[model samples]
Target: MLSGDLDISQAEGLKPMVYLVQPENFDQLGQSFVGKLLDSAEVDGRGHFEFEALKNVEGQVLLEVVVQKKGERYANRLENENPDSDNYMPLIWTRGETLVINAAIDQFQSSVTIENPSTVNASFLELRDLKKNAFLKYKNTLELLQGDEQLLEREKALHEYQAILMQFADATPELFPALMAIKWVSPEGNYERIPEFLVNQGVKWSERYPNDRWVKELAALASKEKLPILVGDQMSNLEFPMVDGSKTSLNAITDGKKLLVLDVWASWCAPCRLENRNVLLPLWQKYHDKGFQVIAYALESNRPAWENAIQKDGANRWLHASHLEGDQNPIMDSLRIHTIPANFILDGNGKVLAKNLHGEDLVQFVANYLGD
Candidate 1:
């Protein structure tokens, strides 16, 4: 049972509705809250609420409590303004423990305190803060180092930071907190880290605790990140809905074109944005009339960043579509795309010709085909 006492006396005019949400996917840069609604409650006049008997919800999961004055409208406003902040704290619930929360309306996190099941989560929260501070220091140190010659040194520094994060993950008593720490420190939805952090760590934990339910759950989650797509596979079709509520498919844009660049990217991806602005846009402008088309497939959780990126990056002329589920999209399941700025050059009949041909190489590929 999850029970909380809301303190609205501190800040008036706040709504009484509180929503419990589950994680769906990360926004572009491991930011934003894209999740499914699990439960909701309206606090009484005395600011009391309870979610009792949450049955059949098996395994370890991170639950978010979203309390607000204006439901959805306020959430949307936060997404538009920040695109990152959740405006709430995450509850890392473990087995055989019920989480109790006390939060005020003025500043949710500032006034919030965890009461029950504090043994594991207290240390986890402290470790997370330390990791944040360490990363900040790492960034500052990186900024001081300049030039290509020092890139190896920079990489070393990053690896050391990752090591500290891995240590924290290992030290956690629960699987969920460990996994959460890994995600918190690692790059956004990075497939490489899945193996190093999740896969490897999961195996060790599973062997150590053969009968542990949390370990099994952690392994199951890690298994989902395995790469399924390859370079030579036939390009799969995706019917993604567009900005105007209209829908478009991959086959539709690939038709009647000699070649098409299936650009898989996201708005929060700085490298992807840079390539779109500096290289892809220019190439698209030059060869658009010559049967060389570009279709930008955004892996984004929010509509604003996805749409704004299209307009801001001059990619509006080309075909664009996203489910706004980011890495969790069904399309990604069939496509097996693990990373952004990834592309597959498709032939006239929608066969994969070349994979990830960027910048001058992309220009050369199209130019070679067009005999320019």
Candidate 2:
């Protein structure tokens, strides 16, 4: 059970949400609070709220207690233009234990305190302070630099920032915060440090428990980072709701095509739209009738934005599909598409021949395969 007390008197009409995040997708907490809303409670006259329905939930998932504003569908990152801050705190809950919290209304995280913290979360405060201090130091030292800064000083700052993360990970190798810190150390999302850190930490843990699936899964993330679902691999048979609210299947769409280009993109991505209009659209116009097709597959969250981009790009002639789940899309996960504007060339059988084609090279590739 998770119970908390907050003085909503300073700011009324807002709601408190408890987001239950899966260990694998814990990064969602940094983004927004939507389908992850495990439970919510009203702040009573006594300034108290409680969530007891988490007993049926499995595993040691991260919890986010956020105060969402009225009329707002969800709370994302703070807008620097608006100056108002988002009120929330990260938490980890263990079953069979009661975690109590007390936080202020104005400064949610600054004055927060916990009672009966989980064993895994015991080092949270220390790590949190280190992170906060490191960020301040970065802002004061690095962010203020205009170009006269030494390359070595910059590297030292980055190293220090990274070391704080590594310090936390090394201190609590099995903790979820440690895993989260790993996400930052590797800016590309895929690098040597990811699996290296996991394996290094798991050395002692694995000796104690050889068949630990946690260690296995953490190690497995490294392979997925290599983008294993491309070049000779057959596309997964899947269907998604189109703009017309009709379901479209990838395999079904490629039925009679000599070649099909799967363009994975999002509306927010400027390069994606630019490529669609400048490159992909023209390619479709030229080669579409000559046994070629394009599936404008969107890893999008907004239906209106997705539809607007399609209409604006004049890509109505091509096939389009999306579940509108954005990062939560299962296809993106299965495909291991960590970046946008990503594409793949698939044959009639839906087997990928080449991946990430764009600009002149993409046009040349099409010409080589299906000459104009």
Name the top lDDT candidate.
1
Off by over 4 Å in 1: 6-16, 22-36, 43-48, 52-62, 68-85, 92-98, 104-111, 116-118, 135-163, 191-195, 209-372
Looking at model 2, residue 320 earns an lDDT score of 89
Estimated TM-score for each candidate:
0.43, 0.48
Per-residue CA lDDT of model 1 for 11-120, tens digit only, reads: 46456767666664333212344566677777888888886435546665567666655535533112211112224555666545677888775556445577854655
Worst ten in a row by lDDT for model 2: 77-86
* Candidate 2 Cα misplacement greater than 4 A, ranges: 7-35, 58-61, 69-71, 75-88, 147-155, 184-214, 223-372
lDDT measured at residue 155 in model 2 versus the true structure, 0 to 100: 44
Residues 139-223 of candidate 2: C-alpha lDDT, one tens digit per residue? 5777655542243345456656768877777776555566555644543355432344545554544554456565455455544
